[model samples]
Target: MEWDIAKKDFKRYLLLERNLSNHSIDAYLNDVQKLEAYCSFKKTALAQVDARFIQQFLVFINDFSISAFTQARLLSGLRTFFAFLQIEYDRKDNPTELVESPRLNRKIPTVLNIEEIDALIAAIDLSTLEGMRNKTILEVLYGCGLRVSELVTLKVSNLYLDVEFVKVEGKGSKERLIPIGHHAIKYLKIYLEEVRPHVPVQMGHEDVVFLNRRGKQLTRVMVFLIIKDLAKKIGLTKPISPHTFRHSFASHLVEGGADLRAVQDMLGHESITTTEIYTHIDKDYLQSVITQYHPRS
Candidate 1:
């Protein structure tokens, strides 16, 4: 099969069989395109390609000066593509099977303290129509540790405020029930009942929880801009996005002695290892723990 045809079929496989997100599928396709370009440069056909050619392609990309994390991600995509080929076309061997991903450095995300969070919320001017909605968004983001996508696409029907939980549709269309804080619930009620009712909601967004002044659902960029404006207003120097709230949520919970497994469930992390990064406790908290529990104390 030609590279284009194989790549097309691989995309379908990712959608139907792997159930990967559009973002993930795009990344995988980009990797395949890179390989196809390499093949063209070497004057090789997909049918005549071998493990050596794939290795050379990897070397070519490495020379382009991409970060190790990106290189590893690209290699992972290649491995998945080759595995798909092996299963579908009855290929004898997978070229990427033996390929090693580069060692990655896990960068810890920035975390905000409770006082900083309070200052952010305090800076919101609740008199404005959009202020109420923005407040609710920030509350839900920090309160639930939800991804920005999950927050933006949140539906009114998904909220179980009486039970203090909302159903979140996370990556891979996986749904998890996350407990909502009383503050989030209170602000959400105010936004839905008082502010949102005044806006003429656009069609097809009737069930959407958050809407812009145009009555349309808010976009991811809108949320980022909202947070950016708020950070600048308060003169807060830390670089933050909607995700900073999420990281702070997990970090605060870990600092407050919440169980790792429970935090994992709330954050909808698929693995406990993924949740472990949030365990970076504050120095004061660590010292307090030592003083409170250590026999030497």
Candidate 2:
């Protein structure tokens, strides 16, 4: 019942039984680590920890001023862990079962308008090899609405340029084929034909679609930095990351009257509700159309 052993077993359960992705498993383990740290600070053992101990840990985390969404996610992780302990280990009780998550505000995601997206891309030099790769990266990110991790892990074999679709290995290793736009395909062809061929491929990364200067797979951090630099270069006031293009992609599609289910499939969202957020982002467009065309308006 030691914290270390408990975390290891929980991770195994998540991997083997739940079949969660590494990103999700890491998040759950991070929550457990937080609890373990709190327990250490209080000189308490896992076996002796109770609901009160969990509540105290919440208070400790609250002092750090994390967002409500983050707090809720952490609590969800803790609840899952304690439930696993109760069911699998035959623990008498679950400490986090009754613990409530923080009330979450529906914060709208930041989305770039078509003009902003264009401006960002237009700012790229496209003269150097890295610039060409960066342009392709932005094009694919916006065109396919890919997650940063998916973009990094994208392989050459998965691309079906003839059919204009790329097989994306999404969350939980789920595979979905997303149609690539003409612009994305055009830039990808240029990068592949003109730039990427010049770089020597590393041993294990021969098939990786994007690579670092060293001929290795590009890291997620590298992608973030690239986007950050571009945003700064263009004097974009709103903070943005790689995910901004994804949000923008969905928003623009919804505004253009794309079906929610179709957008959901494209984005690899397991739930329609996650895709529904794009509808909210398109509310202004919906209202404008109604106001102009509807007799009642």
Q: What C-alpha lDDT does candidate 1 achieve relative to the native structure?
A: 0.89
- Model 1 residue 97 CA deviation (Å) reads 3.0
Q: Mark the 10 consecutive residues where model 1 has the least summed lDDT.
A: 46-55
Predicted candidate 2 versus true structure: per-residue lDDT over 122-201, tens digit per residue: 88998889999999999999999999999999999999999999998888888999999999999999998999998888
Model 1, residue 294: displacement in angstroms? 12
Shift in Å, residue 197, candidate 1 = 0.9
Cα lDDT listed for each candidate: 0.89, 0.91
lDDT of 1 at 153: 93
Choose the strongest candidate by lDDT: 2
Residue-by-residue lDDT tens digits, candidate 1, 212-260: 9989899999999999998898899999999999999998888889999
- The best candidate by TM-score is 1
Deviation (Å) of 80 in candidate 1: 0.7
**Cα RMSDs, all models:** 2.7, 3.4
